[model samples]
Target: GERAASAAARAEAAAATADARARGDAEVLARLKVSEAEAELRGARERLAELAGVEMQRQALATELSGLKAGQEERDRAHAAELARLGETFSGLAGKALEAAQAKLAENAEAVLARHREAAGQNLEANRNSLAELIAPMRETLVKYETRLGEVEQARSEAYGGLKEQLAAVASGQRLVSEEAAKLVSALRSSGKTSGSWGEQQLRNTLEMAGLREGMDFTLQAHQAGEAGGRRPDAIINLPGGRQLIVDSKCSLNDYLAAVEAPGEAERLAALKRHAAAVRGHARGLAEKAYWNEFGAAADFVVMFIPGENFLSAAMEHDLALLAWAFDQRILLAGPINLLALAKTVALVWRQEKLADEAREIGKLGADLHAAIATMADHLGGVGRNLGQAVGSYNEFVGSLERNVLPKARRFTEMGVERGKKAVAALPAVDAAVRPVAARELLAPPADDAAA
Candidate 1:
């Protein structure tokens, strides 16, 4: 535009010069200035030609610009259409996904409701029955308690009547008895009243005091049907590793009681001898049974428990050879004190066995842990080797590309195609009426779906 304006201004100035020269031509001065005017006119014509060439170059640039603008507008339209298609497809996929989620949620909700309703139905009947029957059992139990109360009242009344009769008898006896007579009565009661029940009761009480649990630590009666036949020991003490120790509660103390009640020193000595013999006989009987061979893990000996300390001591004091003789027959004589000591020793043995088992388990666990660590180290070493191999391969491929492929391929800078060429490099410019996009872009997620 500026060049055109300058050309127009110069042309106007030349026309005005011509008019002035024609008017001033008094036939003398006009003829002399004519050559100079012709020279100026010639210079003006040369400037006009230069301006025209510049205008031609400007027209070519304008044509190229118009073509580029047309192609850009066409590509924009194609991009909009592609984007619209992608948006529609995404909306369809999102709608299907939402429907599937809703369907799954509905199915789970129905299943949960069904389960809740079924549980409610089951409990409702139970609750109704409980409400109806709750008072009936209470009334029945109350009547039964009242009956038992009457029986207890009747028993108390009978006991009071018996006590009144016993008080009268005691008053009579007190008037007749002396102090020496009282002492003799007490002695008679102790010696004659002694029985197996007393001894057994004492044995059970001592066992309870020794802190042994029934069933697990000791079985009440050790009897099992086996090829050796059924031989029931009084009790079996459980030991670790399936081992067992037999305990017999029955010890004969009748002859000892007889000796205590003897009137003369000779009779008492004979009865004491008999008591010692009775104990030896019982020990022999236990040895003859030899319960050890019947059990899979029983010890070589069996324990014969004397229920009373005095009875055991009296027999042992009377016969010096009893303990050694019993030991030779595999019968261990244990009084109350000795039995308690044996229980403590067994408890210690159990603890040692438990520790040994724990050590075995810990050793196995350590071995397993060591194996796992070694396996993990092996895997890590293999991974390091694989990574080194991968790096080597990658460097080799990169060297091949740089040293061989890139140097030989033709590049765009060498072409030097002019503006408004028939094509853009290898592609035709007109073919870009609709620009292409990647398939991945067509599958791009929507904004709302992406957030979800």
Candidate 2:
């Protein structure tokens, strides 16, 4: 029984040992799984942080885009407001101009007709009085002159009839003149092409008046071919420094014409509003063309020439800011008078440039002439020095002959040497000295002073 108990205790101890080993193995496995879980957690945390950064970048981009959109909307609103203001202003001006023009026309027409009628009546009355006085005298003079009086009366009636006809013709001519003027205005507004041609013609006339020569000072219908549809400015004015000034004469006048011919005040106002819009549209178009960019040496602003002062004034009357606005678009709105003045200024600039060129040429000529004179003086100085040297040499030779050779030769002649009857010519020392150069440029400065 003792042995069995001891064996049982040993078996229990072995079982206990196996159980502890199993527990330790389970703990190690659990520790390895926990470490793997911690690593996965750290990796997940990094991925989450990367996702947050991506979301932040997206939000930032969206915010920037929103800001840009808001800015664009603001600009659009301001532009729309400006356009509305311009329209309202133009409408009021158009109405006033139209009313004033109509009233003036009516007043002038009435005054002219009244004056003519008064003059005709006064002349007729005077003639009638003179005829009556003459007839009375004739009737008193002779009854046989009654036949001649009848003939005279018939002739006077025919003359009066002719005079009435002439008055009617004059009235008709005046009406015709007014009609013709309206027709001419209408013709100018008939089509874009016609308006453009007329504007160009007016521009040419103005330029000519400003003394600008075509092809030299200015070119008409200048066409420059390009990849993007080429630019064809109505006129390209040549500036002094090989620069250009573009002028576009294709300004739309249809709306302006409509405003002029509108039957009612409301229609006229609407037409004038349209006219202002058209002008703005044209200015915008010119700005887009950017002629200055195309022509390397072109002026920044292009001239938009309106053929009539009234056309420009009518538009500007309502929209006070029209000129400033156009200028902002790199366009200058020029009427006939304004364009004429600008052209005159350009002509003056050209004249001044020509004078400058002539002055430069004169200066160059003067410099060349001075250089030539300096060179001639230098040669003359050299010749003077050489002459001085020759004079000195001649004097030295004369002294040597007189003191050494000529005296010995004379002694020989005294010693009774038979010689020719002709005696040796007496050599005299030269007294004259070469004249020094008078010019300061020819005279050299002292060597020490020059070094200093």
TM-score of each: 0.45, 0.58
* Candidate 1 clashes between residue pairs 3 or more apart in a chain or in different chains: none
Clashing pairs in 2: 89-318
Q: Over 4 Å off in model 1, which ranges? A: 1-212, 226-229, 257-271, 408-410, 416-452
- The true-versus-predicted C-alpha distance at residue 134 of model 1, in Å, is 86
Task: Kindly list the per-residue Cα lDDT of model 1 for residues 244-324, writing each as its tens digit.
Answer: 988886557557877888999999889889988888888998898888977667788998889878888889988889999
Q: Distance from true position, residue 185, model 1, in Å?
A: 14
The regions of model 2 sitting more than 4 angstroms off are 1-183, 415-418, 421-423, 446-451
Superposition-based RMSD of candidate 1 using all C-alpha atoms, in angstroms: 62.3
lDDT of 1 at 196: 48
Residues 228-334, model 2: lDDT tens digits? 77988889999988899999875577888888889999999888878877777788888888888878888989999888888788788767888999999889999
Task: For candidate 1, give the lDDT of residue 119.
Answer: 60
